[model samples]
Target: MIDRRGFLRLGAVGGGAVFMSGLYGKAMAAAGYEDFYFVQLSDSHWGYKGPANPEAQNTLRRAVESVNALAVQPDFIVFTGDLTHTTDDAAERRRRMGEFKQIVGGLKVKDVHFLAGEHDASLDNGAAFHEFFGPSNYSFDHKGVHFIAVDNVSDPGARIGEAQLAWLKADLDKQAKDARIVVLTHRPLFDLAPKWDWATRDGEQAMALLMPYSNVTVFYGHIHQENHHMSGHIAHHAAKSLIFPLPAPGSQDKRTPLPWDPAAPGKGLGFREVEAEAKPVAYQITEFPAMKG
Candidate 1:
């Protein structure tokens, strides 16, 4: 079922590809493992009008087209967060979310997932986000992997809160200690750069609950770039933004959006394609440019 042609074509356009995995290997597939993949588009920042990205309005629409053009459509699509830029008007917020929803609705794939970012939720504790997209935090089982969508941005404090932690604990207790688990969030769980508002306040607790599990990987967004790091045994990978790119963690005093390069318009803007192999429990992540320079 692997469409080699489509995969190659996508890679040819987008470029950077990286591979990540856990300790779980071939033995994990004894129970009928199935390989699957998904698309992750983050930080679209719809309705954002700034010099950082003049193509802000068209960027997301273009990304949708890019995914639709994929030779092999992913099993599902997930928007990590920051779907819209921050707004002071609640009505404007909802309007932006509405418009964002309508645009993405053009996708060929019917099953798409969304999460909240501080811009979309922190203002009113995810009130408008809930009106458009249900439950900020939830979990699901796909093939043989357990996917947990954590809502750290819902609380303006950047904390997952005690309640969600309890829920996560309860959920983890049900799965086998060695379950292949993937945690998706808008903010990096570990402290990547606290001054930049990239770290989750109580993310350590969530990691603690997941620590007992042997196979665990996390995919998050917020910093707006491709970054790879490890917290003990857990591996955290950050996704690029569909909007604009941010400076590396602590690289500069202020976490300002990098100046748009006239030479390469879409240089730092893109999405991700994650191919999951159940047998070896590996994730082949390919980063694709939202728009070519």
Candidate 2:
């Protein structure tokens, strides 16, 4: 039900289950797994104004259109982070956050969730984001899947800190070993590249807490590319951005944002659609280069 580039052709089933297509298909209904789909839209630098991406203002709208056009509507959408670019001015920060909320309000799916990105937190240490969205960290349950939205970007110097870690431990302690868990955050939870600001300081401790779970997947953003890693059985996957992309870890002399490539229009600007409501997630490249260079 999908083509060569790996897009999903949703095949819905009764009783909350769905089909996923990529190079292969998976029922995604094994071991008490219920099926549902969600979209991950990350790093949409809404207030950013620059030539790095001329379509900066329109990119988020384009991403929304793409998701709206999907054959099957996602049960919900999770914007991983970086909803707005950072600025030194406080009023501008509030303006951007308000504008972003207005933009996000247009999504067809009402069950949308937002998290913090360093860009959104770079000013006032996430006060603006908290005002627009609710608490930076929280958890929810849907269709047998337990999701934890951790706030790793709100604190300066990039860390989960001890208080949140304790809360995480208590939260996880209540869950049964067989429960499926997914953690969403704005920063990678490992030492991807500390020099490039891609690594989380106390992420080691957070990982230790999650290490006890048999089914744990960390879906994060900030790196803005399709990359994956593993800390033991836990799989860490990076979702592509709705804004411009950044270079690979240590790929350049310094970690600089890559300009929108006209040749590979969709090279770095797209959201992720996880089919089967879970893994194996069919991470298809979004619609063609949405905007011309």
State each model's CA lDDT, in order.
0.88, 0.76
Give the range where candidate 2 is weakest over 10 consecutive residues by summed lDDT: 11-20
Q: Tell me the spans in candidate 1 whose CA falls farther than 4 Å from its real position.
A: 1-14, 25-27
Write the residue-wise lDDT of candidate 1 on 1-293 in tens digits: 54753564467454676556555744577876688899898999999998898878788998898889877788999999999989999999999999999999999998999999999999999999999999999999888889999999989899999999999999899988878889999999999899999899999999989999988999999999999998888889999998899999999999999998878878788888888877677777888888644
Residue 199 lDDT in candidate 1: 96
Error of 2 at 57 (Å): 1.5
In angstroms, the error of model 2 at 18 is 16
lDDT per residue as tens, model 2, 217-252: 788999987677878877787877777888888878
